[model samples]
Target chain A: MKKYNNIADKLVKSSIANPERIYNYLLYISAAFFSVLIIFPFYFLFVVSITPQHGLAEVRYLPTGFQWENYIDTLEIVPLHQYILNSIIIATITTVFVLIVASLAGYVFGRFKFKGRGVLLVAFLIITYFPGTTYIIPLFRLFTGNISLFGLATPDLYGTPWPVVLPLAGITLPLATFILTVFYSRIPDGLEDAARIEGCTRIGALFRVIVPLSAPAVATVGILTFILVYNEFFFSFLLTDSSYNNWAPLVHGIQMYEVTTVRGSPYHLMAAGSILGLIPVTVLVFLGQKKIVSGLTAGALKE
Target chain B: MGDVILENIVKQYEDVTAVENINLNIKDGEFICLVGPSGCGKSTTLETIAGLTKPTSGEITVADREVTYLPPKDRQIAMVFQNIALFPHMNVHDNISFGLRLRNFDSKEVKKRVENAAEILQIKEILDRMPDELSGGQQQRVAIGRAIVRDPEVFLMDEPLANLDAKLRVHMRTELQRLHKELGTTIIYVTHDQAEAMTMADRIAVLNKGELQQIAPPLKCYNEPANQFVASFIGSPSMNFIEGKIRSGGFESTHINVDINIGNYDDLSIGDPITLGVRPEDVYPKSNSPEIQSQSDPIDAQVDVLEPMGDEIFVYLRLNVGAEDGPTVTETSSADQLLMSVDPDSDVSTKDNIELVIDREKLHLFESGNGNAITHGIGEQTALNQNR
Candidate 1:
């Protein structure tokens, strides 16, 4: 019994001396807790997506039956593939557009000093504070040719993807600009000056030195804008008609499954459609995961 | 073939002048150093010469071509920054060859130049390594290699070794001097360290408050400073200054009980206020040094502090210290204190009373009104004296 107590005391003393053991256990526990908190909803979504239509209301953690046909049925009931393609096109266009415009604006805002620079930057910040709904009605009227600018009739864009794409791009632009500006400003001025002295033009320096150094930041902004536009529901719902031909996005296609079926509302089909809609963004975030994490942490730390 | 001349360069930044009416005639193959304290516009002057910053009014000619309004790329010059701005995304070879590649040099020429620069800077082993993978000294060598590969007519370095440790800094100083000898390019170096300027420069331009104080060879600036500022700025442990008036016989101070016969100054009138300047090494213990001719009259002082610096001992002596109730030394003031350097082997301790004499042959006199030098080596009657 004395030897056993000595062994116990040694274990306690060693653990006390190295608090990393306790901290490691605490870290694992908290990490597992948060992981469950974050991933349970996706797990539930998957379970419901594979559940039969009649079994969704049952009180169960697991699916009652595996119905892989729900995905096919969701596709048949609503044109989800066409909507996904449309979302791909719109999100790509908006990401490219925002990346180009935001990087240039960020470069200007980050590097140059001029009159009213602060005021203009604050103006961009202020634009981010307003909800998208505040401008949705006017934007809808504008896209429908009811609202005109400078006595000219606005182009009718209600049935097309422009209405959704333009508003989403406009709404996401300021935040992307802010991220890129903060990132670009953190790059030392010496690099640009060195490039200029090394026979590069100002724009040449931007492309060769600044852009390559800003790859992680550009990826951060690109992934963020792409995901935001891809998963957007409000603009897609209000901007286009209820037809896949009108280039309605995946979110709108999923929302169409709320119609009453023979059993009840087809929420399982909606869950299946939602899971299908998550593929592109999931792949994107996975591929650029390293850059996104580093970019965010780099922005947080003061040089 | 790279000789740079700056004609009346002035840079005004709205409310402040960074550098004013600066003129420099840097010769071909000259290693000129712009040395001054921080905010002294030394870097501004270098920038104007490199065409990085345009002068408000000036003409900068490099290799006999006027490049006043031209961009940095068109100026036929390359620069090394104090931060050692190696392109972080590129390896050493790519960084060194950035200029050559930008000018659309063929792959063969670019590789040859990059390899040549790597060999010159002794950074050939780091050619495949990224900047972050190298140490600070290696990064600085890569930056220098970048400048060298450009083969521009002129090279500008802005305190390139400032970020290195002391030993590395000293090592790079010798390396840079070797590079200058090998390339024979007109190199303009800017640093706030007087030692770096004195050791590496063919000519040193000292600036203060946006104005050029003196531009001369290093030893000339040391032995004969143009003004009181240069006298104080150039030397280590700086020159000691005493505010006094020139009497009929010599110089006398009001705060301290000290008098020195600075000979007859033709430029100075009787009863005129002048400042006497002497370096720490010029002050000798009177009894020990009998070889110092033309010495001032001995003044009684008490040693306050002794700092042994391995090779030499810096003795801080307090003047007017006979009575116990005499003025005590204050941390904020150094008016009544004189610093003297003695040989390391000499025996000296704090609180010991000693007699100190200034070497009259190395004494400097300046006008108290304008802080301009009146004369250096003021003990001899035949010494050159100028009134300005």
Candidate 2:
């Protein structure tokens, strides 16, 4: 035991003397480990996506043979293009709606001093804490026109794109508003004052100075909202019918593969559909990776 | 044409009064510096004049036009802030011409004016560089350039050089003085640094605790401070204040006594509390008393500390006259210490017992109750009494 203690002390001292080199080696090893951990599932999904359905039992680390027709089969089995189009439209509309409303709400809550501002901000925060399932029944009733507001009948938007777009935008707004509020508030007040002194109105300063400086946060909110609405399953599945024309999103379309297959579950086709669905989100994240990182980390440290 | 006037300006926020009943009448092309310690309402006073902050009740006029309620842009004024609030997204040219472009000036005219401002500031070469790429001094110059291109009647600056390095601050002081000379605009500068005000301002308006103390030339403020606050605040080492009371014979305090004649002023009565203020330079060793024409009697002191600068040495002297028996001397109280500035070459060291005398011609007396000036140059008052 005494001899072991001496060796451990020598090892500790050596590492401490050249800590940076050891630290770098440990950093790279752990980073590479995490990279593999994150990438392995996606890699497996892609390998399974192109493997033939009959070869699944024999499949190990690699696919036995390429079955490129699985992608074609996945598209033909369901109206995947129509679902993709529907998802695109819904995500775009939801993202735009959330951005516009959140930016305004964020600017007001962040900059202006008014009565009940704290209460209102806390109320928005509370809305974010409640899960979507908790409010789905009431939202379904409201959209189907069963729940009237102020003695006026709510519009029947059950099977249309509005049902999915509006609620998703509403669901995403609080978090987006939170990000924007924190980002906008961190900007020096002097910039707005300078703008006003230079002949800009309050709103002009918002667009010209505040909004331009907040591009990273805005892109962050946009990408998150787009990906969320694109892949939303429960709400879109419940709100809209299974008809592709009725604006069922890609997630709903992917779920269709489980039931509509004639034989035992065609897992390859499902994998192909899921892989194809990830393209848009993948491209968006790649494009806005820097912005999202900055947006999340901004205001965490003081200038 | 750009005379600025602020009448009865008062600003109160909830419980605190930022500035109260402030009035200033600035002449055209005058460089006036509003200077004070932090939270002294100097910046608040300047903001009210610039129309950035509305005074609770006051009237302001710029260029002979009443602009009390007008917005800052409509008041024909441009302000430079302490943080150098240049839009970080814009390059130097765009930042300087932001106001011009907002007003929808012809593109050609805006270009010409930006170029002219750049030339005036001598930053013409870096017009295309971003704000973060510029050094601190360059960023401040860009801020000033932004103000100058507006061609407003009054230019308000709020501690624009407070962020620069000490050497750069000194350099910008001369540059700002030159700018004031060339522009001839009614520039109202605000800073907490008295040295900056003393060097650049034609008139320095000293404020303390939301009240304007005095507005006078730099030398007048130094030589004849309007009150004790003005006296202590305007000078670098600060004027030494010795609290005492007026007796029938003269002024009496714990450490020393001075014979001041009360017959010269009707307001002063026997037993009235007074404060004696004398600058560090007015204090001298007893050996130089023969060269001084009107000097006070020697006061015994022991040197506490010595700080020798290139030109002079600041000798902190602990008055030994009353410290052993006086009730005011405590471990923390600085009231018993006097700061004296002697010639740098003078052989003064710590802990040396010495006798010092103040120049009577530069002595200032203030009423302790209201901190108002009672008299300057007590020697002249005594001389007048003797002549009579």
Candidate 3:
């Protein structure tokens, strides 16, 4: 028994000398794989954008030669500058509207314990579970009808920015609301109670105390909504026509340039449009990355 | 101007009664600690007094004003939370000045009050620091500072020191007492810790199961606990309870025989089952020592365990003698034990057969059925004080 105890003690001490070596190697391998997997698409997009239009016939992962004119030429094919500005305007307005609606809705859902609160929140969640394209035909009819459910006089919203803005806000509202509500609930209502006792009204407490403390969550919601709206293709494609190309988002503009002929794809111009479309979101995420990360992981840290 | 009164406050939810008919009057500038176990509605009582939650059927009059239906903002009160809910986004200065600014106090006045509060809490250097940057004690200090700056009639604190380390909690307890003296504000503090209640409260309101148990000065509540719950809850190493009956003219326990002369009471009669209660300090080991040998016969018990806490040792002695011929006194359950707090310097060890005697005057007799004390000492001049 004494000899067996000594052997076990020696085994433990030897294992301690190389603590978690296998775990470290496995972590390093998986991290490298994930980084390559994430970076490969962006690299592919950039390679295809700068590759020569003539060199497209050759089978290659890397660009053979730079066709810098394809960047300028893609603008002519689809009015890419106008489309980029339109996408930016649509995404920005939609994000702003969604944030206002979602914050108020999220605060109500998170903090208040009214009757049917769980049912209401679950109903909102059910809206997100359904694909956004399922109600497109009815939404189009509602906005474009002379007899409007929105109580408008001879309303036709197809050619206007309202059609795009309204649907985008609708799609983004549920997820933003979900994120903000979860974050808001993590914040103890005691803070608001403290504020209320400090001479602030309930609404005043909501604005002054709860909103200020919710900056990380707000950033999370804003970034997620912006990225979704900026890259939104199906709704922007289906909701608006080519005559209203001035209001078309960048995703719709990029899809207009896609031509699959027997020769080859216009991988160069499409990739250029796609990269231009990616800039706003990349800049936004770069700016608010810290807040976004902490916001997403807020409730996981108990303290 | 902070005299607060709750008249029959009853708060009932759909499935549970949070607080039931609690009537308490807190005088102006008194530091009252509401101590109870969790879910005892101590916090609910404090919240209802603060106007944060309305009682279902009650009248609350604070500073002689009927604030029963008024919102929290209309009521002149401030509160600190157990979690120390300092706004994470704001620095200490902003956190302290939040209320003043919201009420549209001028910037200069807000700054003056904020700085004044910072001076009191001794956190002036960290005024610009965010709450996350501060330590737990400093953050709680800032929370108290936030409450003090408002200068409300009443300050409601819900377990404000529960998060700090032990040393910091003690330090903050003294600091809170000093602040209470300096400010002279009515404070309704709630905590689950009986030691905090004993140490700082001018008066402690003991509660159990959504009902108020007793409200009295600390030693009054300690020495004369109103019921079985208050007796058990208010002391460290709790008072031992032995079950038996009152027969002939003395108190009796089933397992041991230490005769004590229990006087006559109105409702207590002969052959009535009684619970015998005694503090650990009252039970002493019998020896040739004159100071410990008392009026009663020495009952032999075996020392089961010894817990030495610095200057004192808690001796757990059980009745280890073989069964005698007197009916075994009804039951011989496992908890038939006696506890004695002796000096740590005393020579005693586990599993030793030692003779014991209890201070007859310090014994507590409670009715076994409802735990009402048939006869209890008022604790004005306790045996512990004489020993000290």
Candidate 4:
């Protein structure tokens, strides 16, 4: 009787089929797996940045000893403070300029009816689809005044900060405009009409009513522009050569440190520079994650 | 001071004529409803009056001033939309006082006006709460409060109660009338519900296919429709139309042959196709009625369906004009089916054979081709006429 009872109990336990529970388990397992995959790099980066002077040559799962001097050494070797200030200036100006141009363009694209609206929108879409590097050669020639457009020589912008700021703003324009356009389109026309009837001109209504409501999209665009200009190295490298290192951004400065100081990859210093460089933007994204999420899912769901 | 007049108002979209030749005069403190089916240009007319849409060519005079080209803000018109349009991010107080603050009104006056509006809308305590926290009905009140604080000369509402539940809608209807009485401002309401138009508007303007069908008091439009479309549209279950021809100094058809007293309709002649219409209540089941037997020829019909409304029953009967037996009715189209409104206490069922009769004095005649009402009654009928 005891043996029969044990066998029946096993059969009854195995008979349970709950697809929902199974799906939940599968979801959790996959999510945990991917989470580790994504987080492992940052953990490794921190570990390498903290490895002691002699620990770089050791093969281990983690640093044997911690070194607090690497961060100080990185700042001392490279003019990290000056590079950070330069990056902040360029990213700030680019973010502001992109916001102004893209928001206005987005408003016009969203609400206005003019000839060639479709064609112009399609052109903007095509520009967004291509990688910015595709225009690198032409942009280099044009900025350096080496090319003529319609038989007119372009202005010389090779060594100044203008080339970096201008192209960064232009490259980021399409994304900002796309975000703001979708945000603007989701607003009901009735709201504008209500504002118009409530004693506001079109532009006044746009600033008073529409702008305040688009805080999430604006934050998203601003953050994206900041991150783009801050991490951008190619334009900064091409625009300002070694003689103009004063205008060199943070990433370009770090790249110079890697190339000039060491013959090959310096894992400890590279990890240390990357960790230090990502601090500001990581803080920003963490702070405004809610806004970014809302902006991305603006028209799809209610909340 | 809020009388509005539109002269030769024509609005043309790229390939569609939204409205054309719309001329209307809405007097001060009068409630006028522009009622029609969707895409009938009633909303276009209302929007034109509100200065939300520019007319291709017209002169819009509001409060004795031409505002044809003026923007909505300068026109002294405030509109309430169907969606309520309460700004989601702002609290009720801010949503209501935003316009005042924008205009640089003194804080004291803005506060006073907002308070007064809140009291009127009965949402004073919830002023600090965001819009999403409020119920749909409360949100609508906030929207109305926003419009009222502007104190515009003309109030335009485009189906303001359309989004509410039926019970709430009925309640809001009375509430709107009360508000109109208290404020006494010119209101132009647009809706597709004839019942709503009839209940609220002092004058109802009916439109069809972008053209005005009739503009008169609700009861006047109901009693004396200028065209067959208005007659059919103004009533529920619609006024029944029995197509026949003028013959032998009366009317004749395969399913129904009745002697209609048109009271000197001289233009009508024999062999002219005419459509006779009667309200459902005016059609009685003569042979089955417990009341005195009708002194008229019995109309042989078979009851197709019975719709039992609470107070009254709508009996749909198919007519028989020529058959081999007592119910000898000819093979006629389904349009020959007659609708009769009877008291709910009557004994009637689906598929029952019965004889019906139409009230002669309540008859209406229209030309078949153009749908022009040749003879129609004027003034209101009894309130308990069972018009459904």
Candidate 5:
């Protein structure tokens, strides 16, 4: 009994001494389980998309028959090519516009102090959570008929891509400005002082020192804006006409076609469409994963 | 190269006057150091000279050109910050070449200067490594190398050695002095450490509350501090202060009931109060030593704490009769902490009562209320009084 107690105590001591190893092992297993849980839905989507239209009814977890026909059928039923073009244009324009305007506003807000700056920042944050419907009527009126301000008329903006793209860019600007501002502020003040001492003008320092050092942060913001623009639906649905119909806008096409009203709906087709739409964005995020992680956590840990 | 001068330089930020009426003449090729405690405005004065900060009023001249309004780069000066400020993304070579590139220096000239500076700093092998890859000392050397490549008329360093460890800081202190000799350039260094200023500068400027207390060679500042502030600040184990009233040919202490003779200054009236200053090194433990006995009866203090450093032991003691109100047992308990440096080999320890004698000539005198030194030259005195 004494020997057994000594052995038990030794085992417990060793386990306690290296608790981190045991904790890490448990973490690895947990990660494996969570990965499977997340990937299962994606696997189901893939299998359903490939399954023949007739075979899908009997299908449970996996595809029964390999029929490329479903893809062709789905493509023919909707204006897929035109919708893809519109999505590319909108996402590209929104991301580019957001990044440019956000970085400019972010630099000013981050590096300078002026009266009402805090109030302006708080106002932006408050508006962030307010419903977009509240602003829609006012925006529509402004675009339809120019409002005069200080003896100048605001430019007429009707039925143009500017109405959709510009509004999306403006909506994204505030938060992007806040994020980039924080990133900019966290850069060591020594760097700017050194640049100024090195004969760099304020603009020169921003370009030569601040910009190069901010590459990772810039990449992070760009990827996030791209994802936000790619996945947006409500604004695209409300603002777009026949000429502006994007792939996200086509999600409404299902409603007009009497698909959403049917009982026990053809969800397999809708799921297939949703899965296809995620491909481009997934590719982009995967390519920029490292930069995104580094940029977001840049200010988190420091010496 | 032209001499630099600050004329009635004043910097005010809202209610705080960071620097006030500082007048200085920095000769060409002179290495000057600004040393002071925190909030003393040594850094503010340096920044104002560098054009990194604009004075609220007054003018600064560098290389004979009035540059108070000029930008830092146009001032033909370079500054090495306390943090070093190396470009982390670039290697040492590129960091050195950046300024030259901005000025559109020839590619060949840029490479030659970069290589030369790297060789001088002995960082030639690590030229390809980014700043983050190097150790603190190496990064510091690289920072200096970057400055060397610019070859500016004046090099300003704001406590560059502060980030280094004690051992490395001492080593680099000598290295910097050697570099200054070889380069023969005017340099302005800022630090709160008197030892750094003493070791590296041809002259030292001590500041307090944005005012220049004194500017002189290290020894001169030490031997002849312009005011009570400089006397106390410029030494380790700081100079000890004793407050008393001037008596006939001596100083009379209310608590101790003892008097110290002041040869000629005894003519100072009996009612006038004054501060008597003495450096720890100038005060000795024995009345028998010829230097100690020359003064009448030496001041007596009881030992409190003895700190033994390798070369010297610091003896902290309290005057048995201390403060003004009474025998001041409580105040004496706190004021009992007087530091005196003795040879480390001495057998003295705590609890031993010791006599402290001041070298009369070395003793400093100041008006009790205003801590200014009583010096002659009424002409210079007018300017001094105006600053006050």
Candidate 6:
């Protein structure tokens, strides 16, 4: 038993001594595997897009040559700048509206007790679970009828950004409120009590203490809101016409034109567009990367 | 410093009453401890005095001003909570001077008061440190310092020493007493620990089940409890209660009967059930067997458990008694078992049947039905003294 124990101890010591080297070797293998899984398709697309229109069929894993002029041709064929602007405006408006409405509702639901609080929460959940397809027909009729309020009348919303941004904002409200509620509830009650003792009224405590203490929670909500608003596709595609090209519609447009003979397989432009679309989100992820991981994992592991 | 008065204060929730008809008059600069078990309304009463809670019906006067409806911030009172509710984001100086800053004190004034409070608590070195950076004891000191700089009329503390370890609790208890003396602030502290109450209270108010049981000096409450609950609640290794019958001349039981020459209760009938309470120190070992006069009671009991506690052995004795009128005492006094403090060096063990003697003069008799003392003791004429 002693001899076996000595052997085990020696094995453990050697393993510990080269832990960093072993870790790096494993990481390198995994990184190579994932990179191939992700980057290969993009590489193939680049070769397809940039190769001369006649050389497309002979395209293999490696690019024959670069034909960067296809990007200018693709831009001329599509309203690329209009799509980018529409996407930015829609996403920015949705995120701002969703955050403000959700935080107020979240604060009330999280901290206050009143009649119908639970019922209101359940109502929000039910609205979230309600199928979006069920509203499409009613929404189509309203857009056709030019639904008007006291004075403000709805315009031709089918091809406008309003329909997409408005409905998407409403849909994101419940989820934003839900996430913020969970975040707000996790803030320690002691902080509120401390603020109360320090001569803070209820509103003062909420703004001065609870909000500051819930910074990580707000950041988590902000990042999730940005990502969700930025990536929403169903409303964007269904509501906008080809003239009003949003990012979601852009992706769809590229796919449709590539497969068709009108723009036979412009894979390189699609890959470059994919790469461009991935930049904002990738940068955002890096900026609040630590908070994202912490927020995501916090729900899994409790201290 | 301020005098606080609660007149017929009542706090009731939907289905439960937290504090019921509490009437207390606390003098200026007095450190009064409201001590009881959980759900005893001591903490609720303290919060009521701090104007943190609106009593269901009552009048609260602080410094002779009716302030029952006032908000806590306007009541000129500060509190230290059990959880040490210090602002985690604020530095120690900012936390201490939060109220001063809120009340719009000038920068120099806030700085001076914060520095003075930090110096007094010896936390000046950590003024720039956040609350989370400090240890539990340091956090507690900052909590107190925060309350101090406000210079509130009353310092309401709700079990402020409960979070510290045993050794630190003891140290903080002494510090609290010293602070109370130095600041001369009227403090209403609530705790369940009797030691904390006895050590620091100018007067300890004992509560049970939302009712004020008794309020008196520590020694007075310990020596002359108004009711059985106070007697049992105040002492460590609590007062032992024995069942017997109060008769003419003395008390009697199945195990043994005692004839005490009590000055009063001569007309008390025989066969009337009563309980006799005696402190552990009152029951001595049998080695010093003094010459018993004819009026003494000698009750012999078998030792059931022996607890050697350095200074004395806590000897658990079981009396051998059986009868139809066999005083049905509850498990708190199970089957004639008694705990007596004997000399530590005494060679006593379990299974040893020891003959013990009771000093009839020190015996306390209470009616079993109501648990009130049947006999009374002498009292002097003082403004704060209770009538006997």
lDDT of each: 0.86, 0.87, 0.80, 0.81, 0.75, 0.75
> What residue runs in model 1 are displaced by over 4 Å at the alpha carbon?
A1-37, A51-60, A72-79, A111-119, A146-151, A200-216, A242-245, A255-269, A293-303, B51-56, B254-266, B285-310, B318-335, B344-358, B379-388
Error of 1 at B293 (Å): 5.1
What lDDT is obtained when candidate 1 is compared to the true structure? 0.86
Model 4 per-residue lDDT tens digits across residues B105-148: 99999999999999999999999988777887887888889999
Candidate of highest lDDT: 2
DockQ of prediction 4: 0.28
Query: Model 5 segments beyond 4 Å from truth?
Result: A1-41, A52-60, A69-86, A107-117, A144-159, A203-217, A237-240, A244-277, A293-303, B104-106, B254-268, B285-288, B291-310, B316-356, B375-388
lDDT tens digits by residue: candidate 6, A100-137:
78878887899777899888887987777877788977
Can you write out model 5's per-residue Cα lDDT over B208-311, one digit (the tens) per residue? 99999899999999888888899889988798777878775445664332243333343356777877777777667773346443343456777777888898
Residue A88 of candidate 2: its Cα lDDT?
Answer: 87
Q: In model 1, what lDDT does residue A187 have?
A: 77
lDDT per residue as tens, model 2, A1-303: 999999999989989999998899999999999999999998888988999989877777899889999999999999787888899889999999999899899999889888998898889878878888999899999999998789998999988998888878888999999899988887778888888888887778888888778888889899989999998888888999988988899988887888898787788888899999888788878888765433332221113
DockQ, 0 to 1 scale, candidate 5: 0.28
* Per-model DockQ against the true two-chain complex: 0.32, 0.27, 0.30, 0.28, 0.28, 0.19
User: Candidate 4: what is its chain A TM-score?
Assistant: 0.83
Clashes of each: 0, 0, 0, 9, 2, 1
Q: Which ten residues in a row have the lowest lDDT in candidate 3 chain B?
A: B378-387
Candidate with better lDDT, 3 vs 4? 4
A189-296: candidate 5 lDDT, tens digit per residue: 677778888879867777677656776777777887777766666666665554433234444443332343345555455555666667777787787775543432
Q: Model 4 compared with the native: what TM-score?
A: 0.85
What TM-scores result for chain A when each predicted structure is judged separately against the true chain A?
0.86, 0.88, 0.83, 0.83, 0.74, 0.69
Backbone clashes counted, model 6: 1
**lDDT tens readout by residue for model 3, A218-265:** 887888888887777776666677543547777767777764223556
Please give, for residues B1-388, the per-residue lDDT of candidate 1 as tens digits: 7999999999999899999899999999999999999999999999998777899998899999999999999999999999888887778788888889889999999988888888888888879987877888888888898898878899999998888899999999999999999999999999999999999999999999889999999999999999999999999999999988887566788444234343544777778888889999999988887898767767888888899999999999888675568657563257678999999998888888888888878988899998999988855322222110
